[model samples]
Target: MQRLFNDCIYRIKALGPEDSTKLFLSRAFGSTNGSCPMELEDAMKKVLKKCGGLPLAIVSIGSLLASYNSPESKHMWERVFKSIGSEMESHPTLEGMRQIVIISYDHLPHHLKACMMYLSIFPEDYVIVKERLLMRWIAEGLVAEKRGLTSMEVAEAYFNELVSRSMIDRAADIVNYYDGREETCRVHDMMLEVMVAKSLEANFISLIGGQYEVMPYDRVRRLSIHGGVEASKQSSFKKTAAGRGRRKNINAMNVEHVRSLSVFELEGHKLLNQLGEFTLLRVLDLEDCKVIGKKHMAHVCRMYLLRFLNLRGTTITVLPRELGDLEHLQALDVRLTFLEGLPETVTALENLECLQYSNKKDYISDGPSKTA
Candidate 1:
């Protein structure tokens, strides 16, 4: 344990005020094309003074300034300066930095808040794929569907918005998908911490890792299970003929309130049976999981409230014909699975807009034709 502790320790110091200011300006107003605007220089100075050389605080303030584009009025910057100073004076600690970040979060438009908080579901330093992330957002009903815009298009705009605000960033190595858009991104560690804090405060998600079990104040609305060697050893799975089977006591908590569930890289058969206890689930993601079979699809078909179901990268070969019972389903992803073909009942899903399968061409079926 002492060796492990020693290995984890790293000695470093915080940036000085001058360096902090440099980083702040570079992030907040850096233009590859030109210099900072002379008109906004004084306001930027005021912002730097209030930041107190804290990098996270500086970045948070810079993100706010970067998003502000209301003709660059002095009064506008004054409001920002006064707000940060007031919050800093009141808190006067690292908690003050937290307050600064929360202010930026609060200033976001209503629709973006959930999208930001959703970032908390992924593990720290997780490399997020834009395609997968957008699908998840659409599944959770976070993306607003418009007549002229596809949900993926709308989600891409939201991703760009968060990037512009410094909440998320592209991975170092860029890989463009078939559409020529970069598909991978990651959240900054500090911002990820803020997301986890806010997610817990709102009971919006319950995250289960290694041996840490977090008890929520009420029903957990969403659950994310991250499985690893340590997590597997720590889990209370019943021994089966195949191996140690994973199971969660969903009945002990407010199972009826769980709206979303994501399990990463675990065998899902035993755990999937627990869905009988969840009545309000709309999103069920078992991406990259192992050995999910046809019997599991039986329970899934009965989940009438389901709007998004993803079985990507699993061993499931066939989707049950009764899947049509999930009349509310909007997005179904079966890519990279063992499935031969979609059941004919899928044509019955009048509300489904996105159908991703293993075929060379992706299917974007508009809701059943009104003329037909």
Candidate 2:
């Protein structure tokens, strides 16, 4: 195998990288999708020279722009054409994720676009449990109900499409949580930023931080808000549902299963016990909620089912020692704090796998702390 690989490398050197790429594509997608794989190869070929030779770079950017069509979407295109600032390239040959996510957003069918944008509620790199995210999407009416398709099933279908398109990435873990588990998702920050911007432009009320009220509870999932926002970003954001155009009565929700709930802050209210109400919570993130205190967390920590927990920027340094009770904890994203270390009780969580160490770095470790 080594000899064969070496000989092939030698032959590829003779064939050159560009031709080699062509040959590889010719074999991979040949006769699969109507046109020859080179059809995409040729399209990418033009971008390759300009974008250097990074496939991801060219493809990410091209795919992002492939389906852009809207009065609002047109504004973004104008930004590109007007020589607007773009982060679509890392190296001369590398593709920028900003462009890729945006392009992916554009090409989505109207329904799919609504579903994808609804997912922007979570913070960047925040893993979303498939079931929980889908439920919210359904609550927001993003999924079109079909005969024989349960709401959960419909949600999974949407997720599969996004995965197939590479619009959203799947974790390396084989255990992808459908109804909520520690298997949360990690999405790019740029995608969320664009969604927030568009939401603002479209009168979609954003509920990040203590900025907005949970109004018009009816069909409130899509043009909705996240658990909370960052203190740094709070000043730039305001608490307003005006971004969301109309208003309707809060729909009677049965709140069946919940995967993740991130509460940042409660503004001047000074206190909130919202999390304790959640029983099936998988990922509970309250990184910098200025108001919440130990009193509020008395019952919050008892969620033995929790998998991911982020209390990074908050004043409370030491987590409730009871956090050890979570026998299912998998990933914990808490950094830049005064807390000493995890309680020995952490060993109870036999399923504990990835512990996210914050430095703006997303690493997936093996057991306790290995490396991605």
Candidate 3:
């Protein structure tokens, strides 16, 4: 916290308050060439010259002052009425961009506002993966579901809209499909941080729990539970996984509220034996989890509608013969797992096109490696 504060202070010092203020005005008031008519541009540029080139500093100051009485707007406008020329320069850090985002974010619809801020979980400069982010959003009940589309598909559409408006950035990650659909994506480093921080206050994001929550599991589509032991809180026991994977809240059966489950991140969590029956589950991520016994595999196989399944970095020796049952699966990220062979059942997936990890040591298949 101190480091971040110090960095901000240092950057501020570098800009020097007066010069930074001049920059701020240009970003907020001076018209960018394409944005406004020449008549308006000339006047706006003078206003911006008052604050040098710092965009964010100007946004904060402007937004704060913009909301006051009409008299205040008049006062600021009068100052602009007198000004000079285009003096605002590009900002040195992302703080200014973030401030502009915050200003715009404050104007979004209440729900969309929450959704936008929740994306800050990944590392800065991280290219956002669409499937993974969408799942978290669905699991949180942030979007309404449609009848024909699977929840994962529904989640992805929302992500597209956010990116289209520049609310988020798209990654250059590409997975050229046999059908030629450009289904790959990613987010910028600084923007990712902005989204994660927003998640804290909005509860807009949830992580697939791992041993050391370092990098978020940005792989699944609709719902990811932190698959760790903290998941089974025996000490403060209240509900089990049997009934809709939710609690009755004995006091008010009418107003049922369920605790959001997180995917356990511990290595042993990979060994799925008896998964808690969660009919309400939207995204299930087993990407870096280590232990996966036969029982867990069977339960996972039967999860008919699972949209995203990640077996990446797991120590599974091979896929169970029952691995091909997920007809509704969209993405199967099996990268870096210890599996030697794939069950022919995998061929049953008409929709499975994104299989990764073909260069490992083993293969339990009669045919050539599909991953290669």
Worst 10 residues of 1 by lDDT: 363-372
Number of residue pairs clashing in candidate 2, backbone atoms closer than 3 angstroms, sequence gap of 3 or more or interchain: 20
Residue 50's lDDT in candidate 1: 73
Per-residue lDDT tens digits for candidate 1, residues 10-127, read 3224567668767776676674233456777777777777766666677777877775634456676778788875545333455566677777787788788899999888776677
The CA-based lDDT of model 3 is what?
Answer: 0.48
Q: Which regions of candidate 3 fall more than 4 Å away from where they truly are?
A: 1-36, 42-52, 55-99, 106-166, 169-204, 207-274, 350-359, 362-372
After superposition of all CA atoms, the RMSD between model 1 and the true structure is 7.5
Assess the local accuracy of residue 364 in candidate 3 as a C-alpha lDDT between 0 and 100.
Answer: 38
Model 1, residue 314: displacement in angstroms? Answer: 0.7
Residue 194 lDDT, candidate 3, scale 0-100: 61
Write candidate 2's Cα lDDT for 172-264 as tens digits. Answer: 432422211343454554566667665555544334332344443322222222333334343333324322211211123222344545443
Clash pairs for candidate 1: none
Better of 2 and 3 by TM-score: 3
Ranking the candidates on TM-score from highest down gives: 1, 3, 2
